[model samples]
Target chain A: MDFLELDAVTKEYPNRSGPPARVMDQVSLSVRQGEFMAVLGPSGCGKSTLLQMAAGLLPVSDGTVRIAGRRIIAPPPEAVYVFQQYTRSLLPWRNVRDNVGFAIEHRLGRRRAREVAEAQLDQVGLEGFGDHFPWQLSGGMQQRVAIARALAAEPAMLLMDEPFSAVDALTRLDLQALILEIWARRRLTVLLVTHDVDEAITLADRIAVLTRRPARMAEMVEVGLPRPRDAVATREAPQFLALRRRLLDRLLLRHDG
Target chain B: MTAERLLRPLPGLCVLALILGGLEAAVDAGLIRRALLPPPSAIAPVLWDMLASGAVLPPLLATLRLVFAGFFIGSAIGVAAGLAMGWFPPVFRLLEPVVELLRPIPKAALVPALMLFLGIGETMKITSVALAVLFPVLVNTLQGVRGVDRVMLDAARTHGWGRAHTLLHLVLPAALPFILAGMRISLGLALVLAVLAEMLAGQGGLGFLILDMQRSFLVRQMYAWLVILAVLGLALNALFLLVERRALHWQPALRP
Candidate 1:
């Protein structure tokens, strides 16, 4: 059995006046342990909704989602979501340490939780910044705090929804590298949703392209690139360029069609 | 440190002081009869005497006790009910019509009927104040709970926070500012109703003291009690603002 499985999953949202609309049309996918998968699609492609459903934030309208053979009927603490908006993700009222500590404290005892949270903060290169509030930190630093919070939970899976889209170009590259390092060190199974093709190309071991609204998987591409990849070298590789061109052509053709 | 900040409140305070001084001068000069509008100086001595004799302490305490009791009880009920209504649409639909029916009827107007059932005592006064305090708190709390961001709710749910945990941790914390604001308004209304109930249906409190002085033709005494009442109201409002400031220190303060 796959570590995480979505078997013929469908999701529908009801409107008060109109007919119920299907957002996911019998979609299915499987994620193995320690796999880094990125889902790339255009805006309003219901990719985020799919992530929400997989994380158990929304119930499947039909079919089933299973994590390690257990069906996901409601949110399970085993998997955590890293939201797109870093500013709104962390509770403003809580300082960085407390925000990270909150998840640990809820999951474990207070003293052990604080220890774990402090350690996770250090791991994220935010050791002394724990006492500072989210607003006091720069956008990149805030997203780091959010990442630390997710890591503190020791979740089996990390569901990211364009977590770097809100930051500057310089910061986005830095964060992408940071995520790669963390994923390698922790051996975390990551499922990231992004619109940036470069981001998908740089980080993902496998990329799943999603179609427009009422999203369905269009294509799945495997990155044959080796581990510990350099950003500059990977972008310069002939294989990388060829893959990017092919994906762009596919996206444009779909758009025109 | 800021020049604009230093200048902002100066003109308003100066104008208020000037108007008050002018009113005192006009009354002292007999442009307005002392019987109708006694000068501040005349009322000051009467207030000193009342305070010295401890004549005002008991009633002030009575009013304070009633206001606090009513405020806590009303706020508790309102917040719980509001959360229920906000989280569950069926509960909102079931309770909304009844609340709307009771809300518009002036809570003060029920004083007579309450007095008839509960008598012209502390019970009637507390009930009146509680009733008056309930609506603003209920409405504000409901609005606050409803206004919580959908994304936050989703975040909480995705984190495996159950319904009770979400209410205690996410919903209550997110809605705190609105709940506090509503309670502040309700506190003022609670005081108003307490005084009104005492004046119309009872024989004690600042309101009754004023009525007593008026009956005895002690206009200065009446004015003195009125000043004390104003001071008390101002002090209570300041206390509430202070508590609100402490509780919501995370929020940036707005300049007026």
Candidate 2:
């Protein structure tokens, strides 16, 4: 049985003065326990809509999204979605630690929540930013704070929607490495949606390429890179280069068509 | 930047001083009618006497009590009602007509009716002030609540936070800047209504005192009451600003 499942999901957005537009059609995917799966597609291809359904942030027009044998009708307690727009996601009214702690605050109480937030902030290499507000931090650091916030809930799965697309190239690489390190450490079921082929190749166990809207799975490419891989070494490897080239050719060919 | 910051308010303060100085000079030089606009120097002595004789305390206390009571009462009702209406469409639909109908009727127009029902007493005075404060707070709150970022609400939902929890922890905090702004506007309106209530139908208040002093040809005492009224308004607004600064310290400073 898959740890996370999306079975024949479809989404239709009703227009006030026009026919309802179907954004995505009959999408199905499954992720095993402790696997990193990346959904790669061009921008505006319903990648975010798919992730939103799995996280129960948006309702599916048809079919079920399930995690751990349970259908997700509402946002499940055991999974958290890390949004790509970190600036919008993190509360400006809260300092870094408080924003991270906000999710679990009610359950743990303030003191313990602060402690949990501190621990997560440390994990994200933001040990001294507990007092700093979101506006005070750089974009990359703010995203790290968001990642820490997602971790604070101690979710079994992380649904990430192009989490690094907004950052600079070097920061994106660094964040990709961070995600890999965290997944390695925690053995989490991670479903990442992105447009970057190299990011999927570098971090994902398998990459699911989605076609343009109405999006559907075009191909599922398995990554054969070795585990505990160094970022520079992995990218330089023959297998990595070959996979990257193949995915790029496929994506570019689709774009041209 | 540091020098610019220090110099920013200097021009405004200097202008204010010059205006006051000019008014005093005009009165001293007998260039302007003193009855219409009393010199700042003469008014200070009369205000001191009123304070020393302790005749000012009762009216000051009366005005403060009414203003504070009305402000708090109106704010409580406005915030709760606004939030409820904003979050739920049904609540808004049910109550929106009543709000729309009542909101536009000049609050002063309602005073005679309120006076007839409640009598010329504290209840009437408080209710008048409360009515004046209510609309602005409610409107601002609704705007604030509706303006909450969609993403923040989604974030809360994903955490399994219920409606009540979300309202308190997420919605209220997001709506705070709007709420405070509304409250500040209501503060000024509240003071106006308080004084107006006294003027219209009052047994005793600062408004009554000012009128009585003027009628008796005690010009300096009348001017003194005006000064007190101005100072009171300034003090309340300053206090409200302090509260706003403390509450919204988390938000980054916005440039005008």
Candidate 3:
């Protein structure tokens, strides 16, 4: 059995007039344990909605989502969603350390939670900046704090909804590398949703191509690139360019069509 | 410090001194009647005498007690109700109509009924002030809770936080700016209502002292009480600002 499964899941919002608006249609996908999967689609393709459903933040209007063979009705404990808008997602009142530790607030006492948060901050290269509030940090650093916060939950699966889309290009590259490294080290099952084909090619084991609106999985492209990837070397590689070209063509073709 | 910093308050201070000096000269020249508008100097001396004789403390303390007690009670009820109404649709649907009906009716108009039930005592005065404070706080808190960013709530939900935990940690802190803003407005209203209640009830408060002195034709003493009230208002406002600065230090706009 797959670690995470979305079997013909669909999402529809009720409208006051006319037919209900559909966001996802029969979107079926299965993620294996420790697999890094990226769902690539056009803008407003309901990719975020799809991730929300998988994270159990939104109810499935039809079908079912299962994690570890258990049906997910509400937010599942073993999964955490990293939002695209890191600045708004983090609690403004909490310092970087406190926000990171917020996940374990109920499970661990204050002291233990702070200790865990500090350790996570250290891992994310924010070691001495624990006392600084979210607004005090740069956009990239704030996103890093958000990542650390998600990790603090010690989730079995990390659901990232266009997580790096808000940063600068240089910062985006750095975060992409950092996330890949973390995934490798932790052996985490990650479902990253994005419109950036290059990003999908860079990090994912398999790229799940999605249709424009009322999204459905169109194709699954296997990324044959070797692990322990380097930013400069990986992009320069023939396999990387080939995979990037294929994914981009698929995304653009579907978008234009 | 910069030259600009040094001269920041100069214009206001100069204008105040000029006004006081002008008023004193006008009164001495008999252009303005002393009985109608006592000069600042005469009012100052009377204020000093009242403080020294310990005559002001009882009324001042009474007013303070009413304001604070009403402020706290009103704030507690307002925040609790606002949180409930904001988070739960059922609660909002049930209470919204009743709240709207009561909100527009001036609190002073209810004083007669309140006095009839509770008597012209501490409870009546405090309840009047509490009613005055309640509306602004409750309305602001509800707006604040409703105004909380959707993505933040999504973040909380995705983290597996239950409704109670989410509201306690996420909603409350996010709504703090609104709550504090309401508190400041309510603080001023509380003081106003407390005095109004005291005056109407003929109770032992600064308002009563002012009325009592005026009836006896103690013009300077009445003027002195007015000064004390102005100072009290200024002091309360200053204290509230201090608390606001400390509490919302994390807010980017409020950062020093």
Best by TM-score: 3
Q: For model 2, state the Cα shift of residue B185 in Å.
A: 0.7
TM-score of 1: 0.93
Cα error, candidate 1, residue B38 (Å): 1.4
Please give the lDDT score at residue B222 for candidate 3.
Answer: 88
lDDT per residue, candidate 2, A118-232, as tens digits? Answer: 9999999899999998988889999999999999999989999999999998888788888889999988999999998888988989999988888988998999898987766
Candidate 1 per-residue lDDT, tens place, B1-256, comes to: 5999999999999998898799899987879987888877777788898899998799888888888988888899889988898888999999999999998988889999998899988888888898888888898889999998887777676666668777877788888899999999898899889889878975788887788888899898888888888888899999999898877767656312
Model 3 iRMSD vs. native = 1.0
Deviation in angstroms for B70 in model 1?
A: 1.5
Fraction of true contacts retained by every candidate, in order, equals 0.44, 0.73, 0.81
TM-score of each: 0.93, 0.94, 0.96
* Model 3 lDDT tens row, B11-129: 99999999999999999999999998899898888899999999889989999999999999999899999999999999999999999999998888888899999899999999999
CAPRI verdict on model 1?
medium
Question: For candidate 1, lDDT tens digit of each residue in A165-222?
Answer: 9999999988998899899998888899998888888888899898887888888899
Residue A210's lDDT within candidate 1 is 83
TM-score of candidate 2 relative to the true fold = 0.94
For the predicted complex of model 3, DockQ is: 0.81
Q: Is the docking of candidate 2 incorrect, acceptable, medium or high quality?
A: medium
